[model samples]
Target chain A: MKHNFGAGPGILPQEVLKQAAAGVLDFNGIGLSILEISHRSPEFEGVLNEAVKLVKEELGVPEGYSVLFLQGGASTQFAMVPYNLLPEGGKAAYVESGVWANKALKEAKYFGDVEVIATAKDKNFTYIPKDFTVPADAAYLHLTSNNTIYGTQLQEFPASPIPVVCDMSSDIFSRKVNVADFGLIYAGAQKNMGPAGTTLVIVKDELLGKADRKIPSMFNYQAQIDGGSMYNTPPVFAIYVSMLTLRWLKAKGGVEAIQKENEEKARVLYEEIDRNPLFKGVCVPEDRSHMNVCFLVENPEHEKPFLKFAEERGIEGIKGHRSAGGFRASIYNALPITSVYVLVEAMQEFAEKNK
Target chain B: MKHNFGAGPGILPQEVLKQAAAGVLDFNGIGLSILEISHRSPEFEGVLNEAVKLVKEELGVPEGYSVLFLQGGASTQFAMVPYNLLPEGGKAAYVESGVWANKALKEAKYFGDVEVIATAKDKNFTYIPKDFTVPADAAYLHLTSNNTIYGTQLQEFPASPIPVVCDMSSDIFSRKVNVADFGLIYAGAQKNMGPAGTTLVIVKDELLGKADRKIPSMFNYQAQIDGGSMYNTPPVFAIYVSMLTLRWLKAKGGVEAIQKENEEKARVLYEEIDRNPLFKGVCVPEDRSHMNVCFLVENPEHEKPFLKFAEERGIEGIKGHRSAGGFRASIYNALPITSVYVLVEAMQEFAEKNK
Candidate 1:
């Protein structure tokens, strides 16, 4: 009955974990472990196919887009996005909202010129930077939808003149997005999806082949699309587990249904953080991420005590990132609202004890 | 009762599978699934550390080398190798032993000049080319230690004036090799190591940083070494299973013991292939792989019937690659000699029935 709140490589549905465990022993009664089967095998091909289909169905992805399951997490995408989309000597616009965004822009610099059109770095990224112009001359505008460390999110995507490449690593599928709005959306599966091996890349088919750089087969979005994400041996088991998780999401009535649950979970948790005198929210109210609710204790001494208290109550991974030193309760799609209730109860109990 | 002989994402030890399943359910009694735990958690860090240590110990990797568990399989490494090693306008030599080697060379061309010094393509890669001079002027020489599709392996590593980078994907832990001989050795963890998703890179420290190109952090060996293969969220579960498999290998008396067993397995299977009137070995006798035993039906009509007969006895994944038509029984490290005996018995019985 432990509540998992770790950010990225975060919580997954219990049933998905059980099915994944069972598959590791005997996948679909084939007497073969999922970990031992060939990716070319019909069984694994089916898993990869279903996983891609679920991503499309869950996100309502338009037909003109390609959904890819690739390796190397979102960090790899920081380089890949520019490598594929940004042409030689072309510039890409970036909004540096957090550490990840800063890293993304830095990687983009290796390929071509980068313009930091907007950033919330001044306030330590406590709010998403909204007032910025999308440089039309730029090849693309790169954005981080949710800053996991800073607990801020782009509440609404800005209408851009050029292609928008968003790193939705932390908050994908927690809410619905118009697939047609962005040229590309990449998310590491560790958060709100499944595990840590595979990355989900949804790219507009037309946005590719414009970079004019000689891209390696693995890094080329078109190459991956042409191979149907099997250009080489894919991260098989991770894709399989992700398929299981997506199946669980579909069974729970898809992304729209889960989005409501996520909103409610964040609502209650944030409400508790606000009402309790000992705790305070970390980010601006409007920009606060529903996926990760970052907060701080008013009395710094209460931080250690509250963490231990939460742990005793089966609350785990609530500790904030070292960069943002307080607490962060990540309410991913798989994290049940009941777990949020438990956290709320613990917070209240701790507040009462301190008083 | 089933014998898995898939080329890769191949068989893992049953005990390793069981433990992996248990860990997926509740990793180390931590009340969290291994898939759900943070990569930075002490638990997973311990797992990653032990995996690196085990790779070093099992391979007798000298202190000057680094062991990296990366993602995107060997295909990714094809580009990464050249990206990190081949400097701007520098020449690298490659041996085109098989399809994989051809692909590796193709990737190298993207970075700099790639010279194919030796090739077995004339014989459909039926043998390993032995006589080739290592060009002293080249930055490094690339070689494929074993060709999975062609069933040919380099029985002896060639002495080189420059550095040697080898793709040992299919035969890494099946036998021991001197780490000092190579500048870089990378293998996708599917054949002899673990499942698909992770790649093992063992590189001599002195070979890095000479490539005077703006190498992205993920592809740069120096950055990866600095981060200790945690440059990004590595293929966590894949690395975990690999560690478990390596641990299993160590307990089974490490690579030296496995080599003898692998040799015996290959000996008996190849002996059966030679003895059977209906079957014939695919590659040259001197160069046949101990890991992937490829053979052809003397009568083309016998191929399907022989496959069915083998399948009836619960023999799996023995079908040859489409390019090389016949059968391929991959006797990887985790595959027991008993499984080889089962495959050999099936071949004998099939031949008797045909006779």
Candidate 2:
């Protein structure tokens, strides 16, 4: 009965792991353990104020947006979105498209004059770079909407007049978009939210004090949005299991009904890896990746007995990305349409006993 | 029953929260939810290889020390320990003492020629500055062993012909020193390891390629010690609840028996805030802080009825740090000596019912 498809600390939501394992045994009863409380205590300020008002009511996030939650991941917002809004020696732009968008354009060229402009690194990034430009007084363009190790995504985005910033860690929320077309987004709560030491961010309250250096008040996103992310000592049980995986993504029908169950679990595992003749997928099926599908196999020696015949039929983490080898799966937003139907019936029983 | 005196994301260890709430419901059984697996799976590489071999067999840490498990806390190692050990314009030598050792000496003075050399900010820092001089061909001396907002504690660290580094975010492992007398240490796993997106660090393998520049492969501590902290995608359920609080600190006897139960829970709350005349204490009883004690309130209107009588006796995070306000507690290492005897019997029944 196990079937995770691991990518970015992957799968979650068995009632957000039985209410994050009953809030580490107590929490709501407040007998401690939500890793023993206190992110400025009103019981973790009601779990970071109802997980930032359930991400501004499940991502409508407008009315002068701010969010925050922070703690280095999404590679510390690629040097905190160019150290809190570039400014000094300005010029921004970046795009690249893999390995965390060229490691956030090499941490925003160690603080300014960035400008890669656009690149899928000659397609080894597999795709996602059309009509680049965007530099009329550039101080913010950056990208990486999705590229968990070259699976590639961005499906839409592009039309910018400056101010954008993204990194959406691994295809944020996995669907509904337009958080007012960005002015900084961030993500990293270990994919689809709930693990790695939390990182969210959001921002757009006037793109924050226009950076003239001296940032580090914990990488100032206006000092963590004026101390609501409680200035410091956060990462309280990874934002309380990312507020029970955003209240199990607003009781299963929020980000537009979980983007129709994440495009039907990436169209049933990319139509059984494009009609499996021993499989094939690696990006470019219109920049493949509804959350890391990646593939390859026409007999790479049945990749270690098709990952031990899908790990003896429980079908776990699919394995791929020792710089991209043979399988990947991933299906993020709390992956479970019976775990992509047990990974498309274990890739149709490993292509009928190895074709 | 809810007495989490919030120092770090404070307090943990009830058999490491019942084996981290049974590994978020089935990690060992592999039914999944150690936050949905796969940090390069061998079941998260046997949970990051037995949490870096139980921090080198409970901090004996020999053989070219490495450890790592990072994510920007310890304020991103105050600019990744002078961007991976200084150099261009090199210098080093800090020690300022209070607010995060003066924010790691203002981020190692933006990367070079630092030298605060020594300072308790002329006693306003309340103590711990003693005899200075740590220069001798500098490039690494820094300190801050335990000052979670000025409660002070260096209790013996100064024999540096350079290369020391410390931070030990809020007195690491409560007590028991000489992890090969420092050459990098860090701590921020929300005080005494286990939450807040994991920080740890450790270091010292010939301080790795003496940093000339270009870190940022997640602030490269030698690329998280040559990718053993998985070089990226770490912070997996805060390193599996910091390997279930280092296996409940090696079945409760490691770190020299939790340094005699953290010196009998900081000597029964600094002997009831020094025989209470309505509380006092804040450092300098030979540099206090066995792990953040900090106190105050001989009658400044009994500091708002001793923090609303320790938050109506449930005794929560004891307030202080409105830049040194009036009460800190913190007593980390999973805090219980019966929650510092329920915060020194709720500060002696709020000083005998407010004197």
Candidate 3:
């Protein structure tokens, strides 16, 4: 019983792993291995179709929206959002909060004029800015829904005058969302869904083809939507595994149930960190991410010892990202509640031992 | 014992499949599965480093070349090549021969001035045009090393005035080549190497940073190279499978031995097609691809019967692409000599029954 609290390359359910492992050898009793199957083959086409269908069904995607499975993860989508929607010489509004948000803004600058509406960079990205104005003239208001490195999430997606484009990379599929609220939303599959390979881009149909630039076919959301994400050979195995994970999500009662479990897990960890004498929570309580719980150990010496304790206890991937030090426990959708309790136990045990 | 002749998501060695499936469960005895492990983890980094090292070693890559594993298939690279290599307002030369070649040329037009030095469109893409003269002032001379759909291969790369950029997507790693001859070479790993998510790019380091436009980080080869393909979460599973396949290729004595075996397989099948009274070879003998072997049946009615015959004999994915009719059997690196014999026998039986 290992407790893995990894960041994206999402921690998957063990059963999903077993099924994925089985698929590598023979998928659904097909004589050929999934790893060797051609993307154009009927078998893989079925996998692609089912994955698209499940994501739409689970998300309650509206009639006009198209759910596409694309490549290059959230980073690609960062640039692709502007490339597909921002007309030449147009301007888009952006709210920067974390590394990914800044990266998105930087990429957008290449396509068109970008208006920086607001940024939490001044405060080192510890909190989500609630009062940012989106200019009506801007093509779109781009923001990161969840900041993984900063351990923050935009709890309430404030109404924007322009169309909303959200990079929900680390927190998508963990909660229910209003599909109509955003013009486009992209999530790297690794965090809430599957492994690293495909990015799920849900875009409103009417918003496409407005951009004047010659968008690369791979980054052109319209082309991908028209091609059913099979414009080229898709990341077949990754999509298959994503389909399985989505199936698991549906079977466990969809996003609502998963969201409830997620809240409880976060509450337990955050509450423990608040009550425990040896640690301090990093993010502001209101904006703290349920997915990534960042905290610092009191006394720099305890940091090393506690990490060692967790390591010996078989708790993996708790190490914080390089930019944001201390520790980060990314309790994503597939992470079990039991893992949280185990991590809390490690924290308590370490404090007792050192005290 | 399925005779898989699929045109991509490269056919894996039996041992490679078993090992890959096992890695999905427990990678190197690390309690975490490969799919769940973070891309930044030491284990995954090892996989990435080894994959790069093996590819470079096998290709005998020159000292200054940078090998990168990236997401988005060859189609993404179609535009990314010009977006990175061709400076703003500069012209690049291209040889258009097959379906992929036409697509590449079309995409390159968006990035800069594309001069089609020669095209085989007049012949319905049946042959490679060797009479084209590349302009001395062109940024690069881009060409497809092998045409998968038309079954045509460039038997010898002609001297180019400008730097050569080769799209070796369909035939990379199948044969040895002088890496110094090309300024850049990119292959979608699905064909001769890994699965369908990642692309392998080998570029001359000196040629990077010359593009006048600001490239999106995901599409920017220099950024990806500097970051070791971890500029973002790479397709972890794809790279791992690629590494396993690369290891298998190395164990099989690398490219030289595989090339000999590939030659024998192609020769046996080509000879059978040529000798058979009921069939005709499509590609010119001198420019025939060892990877993709296409042919035509004497009687158009036999197409269906032949397809059914191949299916019954457990030969999957032998059906021809829609654009190119009749039949196509892609004997990639992993396709065994025995599979070719089996296919030849099936062809012989079909002709005998039809005749």
Give all TM-scores, in the order shown.
Answer: 0.99, 0.36, 0.99
Go through the candidates in order and give each one's C-alpha lDDT: 0.93, 0.81, 0.90
Error of 1 at A5 (Å): 0.9
What does candidate 3's lDDT look like per residue over B276-345, in tens digits? 9888989778989999999999889888888999889888787778999878999999999999999999
Query: What fraction of the native alpha-carbon contacts across the interface, defined at 8 angstroms, is recovered by model 1?
Result: 0.89
Report how far residue B302 has shifted in candidate 3, in Å: 1.3
Q: List model 1 lDDT by residue over B1-355, tens digit each.
A: 8999999889999999999999999999999999999999999999999999999999999988989999988999999999998999999999999999999999999999999999999999999998899999999999999999989999999999999999999999999899999999999999988989999999998888888888988888899999989988888899899999999999999999999999999999999988888899999999999999999999999888889999999999999998997999999999999999898888887777778
At residue A276, candidate 2 shows an lDDT of 79
- Model 3 clash pairs are A10-A190
| Residue-level lDDT tens digits of model 3 in A228-264 | 8989989999999999999999999999999999999
Q: Summarize candidate 2's per-residue lDDT along A1-355 as a digit string, tens digits.
A: 8777777777777877888888888878767777766566677788889989998888899889889787767776787788778877887888888777887788788877888878877768888887777878887888888887767788888888878888887878778888998987988888887887688988898878867777657777887788887766777877888888888899888788888888888988888888878888887888787988888888778888888888888777778777766777788888778878877887897788766
Whichever of 2 and 3 has more TM-score, that candidate is: 3
DockQ of each: 0.90, 0.26, 0.84
Q: What does the lDDT read for residue A132 in candidate 2?
A: 70
Ranking by DockQ: 1, 3, 2
Return model 1's CA RMSD, one decimal.
Answer: 0.7
- Regarding DockQ, does 2 or 3 come out ahead? 3
In terms of lDDT, the poorest run of 10 residues in model 2 chain A is A35-44
